[model samples]
Target: MTNPTANDKWFQDRAVEQIHMDQLKRVELFNGRAAMLGIVIGILTEAITGSGIAHQIGLGALVDGYAACRTQFLPFCF
Candidate 1:
């Protein structure tokens, strides 16, 4: 598979510019990276507890109650 290569000079120039001229692109990039980190943390928590991310925090009871209420046809779950 042949992939097109980026212009080295342009890439270098953009990298240098970003160092001082932080733009929306930088914010978006950081947001995406933070989201990835959150997902990894969630996955690690699940692996350690063998439970969903919700239970990893403190919503396990609320979620379980809601689920039970829904299954048993109760009026209130929360």
Candidate 2:
């Protein structure tokens, strides 16, 4: 079926049935999805270069400027 109507039983069973209606479950689902997206992006960027994505993009200089503003510094160097 190319396009299933809302009234169709298959659509209800296949699509709507899979969704989490509860607020907490929906938040957990979204969090999981976001984590998966981050993991994929991290791995892809890492595969392109041997270094972590932040270092590959030269983010240390940006952090160095902000380090003194905070007692706890960003761990770019260490």
Candidate 3:
């Protein structure tokens, strides 16, 4: 007495899949944005802390300067 073929579930399945895919894309976008923000914050933090420490050590005084350059610059650059 019922027409099962008229109630095809394919459309429902497709709708669900599309929703999931959209959510995945949004998550990926958020992750990319968060990574970019993290990199900026990290660089700013390093710039502030590194320069402050280097200044205290005497930036151009050969002995301490070269040592600081080697110890600090190397780690930060890498």
Candidate 4:
């Protein structure tokens, strides 16, 4: 017969793993949202500024900034 204590430990481990996976999924979701928002904001800024160069630079910078924030402030976020 399987030991109840071992079975409980297995379930506990699985729960921990599932929690980690959920957190990761949330992080990915937030990151995607941040990137999309950055893109929209960047496009609007470029349109207002009337500069194609600004559009490219702004988009890249905003996306990278969001990614950096996600990595550095993930704990605070979720």
Highest TM-score, which number?
4
The local distance difference test score of model 2 is 0.67
Candidate achieving higher lDDT, 2 or 4: 4
- Predicted model with the maximum lDDT: 1
Per residue, candidate 1 scores C-alpha lDDT tens digits across 1-78 of 533355767788889988756777788899999999999999998998799888888666556866657676456655
TM-score per prediction, in order, is 0.50, 0.41, 0.55, 0.64
Worst 10 residues of 4 by lDDT: 54-63
Q: Where does candidate 3 have its weakest 10-residue lDDT segment?
A: 53-62
Error of 4 at 2 (Å): 0.5
Candidate models: Cα lDDT each: 0.78, 0.67, 0.69, 0.75
Q: For residues 1-78, what per-residue lDDT tens digits would candidate 3 score against the true structure?
A: 756665557677888999999999999999999999977776776587774433444653333546656677444433
Q: By lDDT, rank the candidates, best first.
A: 1, 4, 3, 2
Clashing pairs in 2: none
Stretches > 4 Å off in candidate 3: 1-7, 51-78
User: Which candidate would rank higher by TM-score, 2 or 3?
Assistant: 3
- State residue 25's C-alpha deviation in candidate 2, in Å: 0.3
Candidate 2: segments with Cα more than 4 A from true spot:
1-21, 53-78
Candidate 1 residue spans exceeding 4 A from truth: 1-22, 65-78
Question: 1-78, model 4: which lDDT tens digit per residue?
Answer: 999999999999999999999999999999999999998887887788766544367544334547646666344443
